[model samples]
Target: MADRLLDAMARSASRLYGGEAVSELEHALQCAELARAAGADEELQLACLLHDVGRYAVDPSLVFDTGEPSRAGPHARGHHEVGAELLAPWVPERVAWCVRAHADAKRYLCATEPDYFARLSAASRHTLRLQGGVMTAVEVARLAVHPWLPDALALRRWDDGAKVVGKATRPLSAWAPLIRRCFDR
Candidate 1:
């Protein structure tokens, strides 16, 4: 079962990364690795690894494990809505919603909850437009239906944690045991 999950993830990562950057599989795996190191729960760790699984549904190109030269920011801007639509079918609604919204939390939080703007990346100071505009009120309203909003929000926080290069990202293997633990819980 896990093998199938990882395989499906490989496909999503391939297309969503915009013909450049790390394969979507690599990045999603990295996110899951990160969550595992930080002691995140199985579902959340699973969320980290497969957040963008939606990409597979939207674009099969992402399903491949191919590599390409990326122009940097396109991975963030190009994939979110498509990711959301695709994920709605394969995973829980909240996981898909949070994954879709991970890159643009500031805008949604900023408009609805001004305090959130302060939590945005310090580096984002120079790349506002480059990161894509914030999520719209309608989108935010829709995502609210996600059953795992709080968990999704935490996943969003860790998404940022997983970004720094060579930082101590936990390995995906570490979550295997954790995944089992979650079932017993």
Candidate 2:
């Protein structure tokens, strides 16, 4: 399972991340590093590393409406939902929740934090529209009571900060053992 998961991540190593300066793998590594630096547990770190795995794991040919209310889009699942679903059988529920809610975390931040939208990168800004713009008051209320909300928000912070062009990060090899352990768990 770990090997398969790692391979999925490797396939995106050279792929640009939503027009961000960094490649998808780079963003993943950097996000994991940020989690580590913040003293997050292994589960959270792994969640950060594989948060965007859906982009590579799911069929790219699948098309969907980005503005759909269900967050499922029209014909396909959103990447966050896909990633969480893919990880659900391997990792803990908390990890999968973090993966699933990171986008909602972005939406949460945008709605609750004035000036947050302006700080987003251009690519993130564009994706934000596709991610349902901002949370409605009811949506915010729903997310606020989730037990895992704090971890998801932390993962979101790491995701937002992981887009440096040439930032040094631990290689995928360094994380292979950790990935295996998570899968084994």
Candidate 3:
């Protein structure tokens, strides 16, 4: 399973993350680096690494064909949901939850922090509107109580910061042990 996940990521090494400056693999590696630097536990670091796997797991025709997700096509599952479900069988439940909630974490931040929206990159800003924009008060209240909210929010911050064009980060091969541990768990 770890090899499967790593292979999928390896396949994405050349694919740019929509309009982001890095490839999808690069973005994932960078996010994992951020999590590791922040001293996040292995599960949280794993969550950061695979949070966007849904974008790769889904039918390519249905996802990011254009700069934005296609609204006209068959109801495409959100990448977050897809990613979380994909990893749920191998990783801890909290790791899956963090993967699922990272997008909502962005909405939470945008709603709760005024300047947060402005910090988004152009592609992210475009997707934010499609992703439901700021959270409603009710939505905010619900997410606030989720046990994995902090991890999700932390992953979101790393996600946002991982778009550096040429940043050096550990290669995907270095993560095999961590991925294997999660799978073995």
Candidate 4:
């Protein structure tokens, strides 16, 4: 039998990430390997792999399952918000915050610092102006609310870096040996 952790990961994916081309298993596995190859620490590698596991609490519809870039237009559905809600129970609040904050890395820029202020996408800039809740001050407060905030930032960066396109994207099964190697260490 697969280990319980692996099993839980699989069930979470099946429950929340079905039908979308973004296979849950594959996405997590790729994130893990990306973190690992990039020399991230073990916890971060795990975070990379499981960050979206919270999606299990959201729709089982497969919408968050694609790598399509969010373009300027009608707001489509997103998993990070609901996924953040799902993950709050299982990991550090900062981890969940990372997932939520990642959905619109731009929103955080508007809510918080001035450094990234100018780089904002035109759509995200519009989102910021529209008012009151694309990403609220409360969420920003929570994002800064954890000691792991730095770690969460790192994990989010790692997550973004993992989203390569097409066949160049690696497979989950390909990482089983790597996971085993890490686990055995």
Candidate 5:
């Protein structure tokens, strides 16, 4: 399973989102590096690494082809929910929850933090509009109580920063041990 997951990531590494500066693998590795630097537990770091896996898991044609409006929803089947479901069989509940909520975490931060929206990359900003935009006051208050919100928000921050072009990090193979360690078995 671990090898399969790594292979999928490698296969999708060259596929870039419309506005993201980094390829999918680079973003994932960078996010994992950020989580490790912050001393996050293995599960959180793994969550950061795989939060966007759904983009690879789903039909690439659905994600990359912009002709259909139905395919453009950021939280559609192409986003967090599919990734979380894919990881749930192997990963911790915390990791799955973080992946599931990372998109919402972005909305939460944009609503609650000043200048947070402005800090988003152009691609992210474009997707944010598709992702229900900023959270309303009520939505913000609702998400504040989620147990996984902090981890999700942290992952979101890492996700945002992981777009650095040409940033170097450990190879994808270097993460296999951590990925194996976190597998639920």
Candidate 6:
């Protein structure tokens, strides 16, 4: 299962989301690197690495090829939920929860932090509106106590910073052992 999952990531590595300087794999590797640099636990690192797997899982034709704001429909299965669901069988619940909530964490941060929204990349900012825009006060109150909120928020920070063009990082294969370990348990 781990091999198959990693293989899928490898196959989709070159497919780029419009406007992003980095490919999906690059973003994933960078996010994972950020987590590791911050001394995050293995599960958190894995969560960061796999948070966007759902984008690859879905039909590529359905994904927006342009930088335009993505609309709801096929894209709404949400890379977050899809990735979490894919990893749920093998990973810790905390890891799955982090993957699932990362998108909402973005929305949460955009609402609660004054400068956060402005810091978002153009693609991210566009997706934000499509992702239900800023959270309502009620939504904020509910997410405040979520068990995985902090990790999700942390992952979001890494996700945002991972889009550097031509940034160097370890290859995807380097992550296999960690991914296998998460699955092995």
Q: Any runs in candidate 4 off by more than 4 Å, and if so which? A: 1-4, 8-21, 56-146, 166-185
lDDT of 3 at 77: 57
The prediction achieving the highest TM-score against the true structure is 3
Give model 6's TM-score versus the native structure.
Answer: 0.89
TM-scores for candidates 1 onward, in order? 0.52, 0.91, 0.92, 0.49, 0.88, 0.89
lDDT of 3 by residue, 1-185 (tens): 77777888999898888788789999999999999999999889999999999877556445433354544257565678777888988888999999989889999999999899989999888777767789999999998988779899999999999999899998898998888887755
- The residue-by-residue lDDT of candidate 4 on 1-185, one tens digit each, is 12444566666545323233445665576667777777987656656776665444334453233233243124434556556665556555555666665545545545566655475434334434432334587878765666666666666455544443332545555545544544343
1 or 5, greater by TM-score: 5
| Every candidate's lDDT | 0.55, 0.85, 0.85, 0.53, 0.81, 0.82
Give lDDT for model 2. 0.85
Compared to the true structure, candidate 5 yields what TM-score?
0.88
Query: How many backbone clashes can be found in candidate 4?
Result: 0
Candidate 1: regions farther than 4 A off: 1-27, 37-39, 54-78, 112-132, 135-147, 173-185
The better-scoring model by lDDT among 2 and 5 is 2
Name every residue pair that clashes in candidate 1.
Answer: 11-62, 11-63, 13-24, 13-25, 14-62, 15-62, 54-87
Worst 10 residues of 6 by lDDT: 60-69
Model 3, position 90, has a per-residue lDDT of: 86
Tell me the deviation in Å of residue 150 in model 6: 1.0
What's the distance in Å from true for residue 66, model 2?
9.5
The residue-by-residue lDDT of candidate 1 on 74-129, one tens digit each, is: 34333455566654555556566667666566455555776666765554333334
**Residue-wise C-alpha lDDT for candidate 6, range 97-183, written one tens digit per residue:** 998888799999998999999898888887777567899999999999987788999999999999888999999999999888776
TM-score of 1: 0.52
Error of 1 at 69 (Å): 13
Candidates, ranked, TM-score: 3, 2, 6, 5, 1, 4
| Residue 82 accuracy (lDDT) in model 5 | 74
CA error at residue 16 for candidate 6, angstroms? 1.4
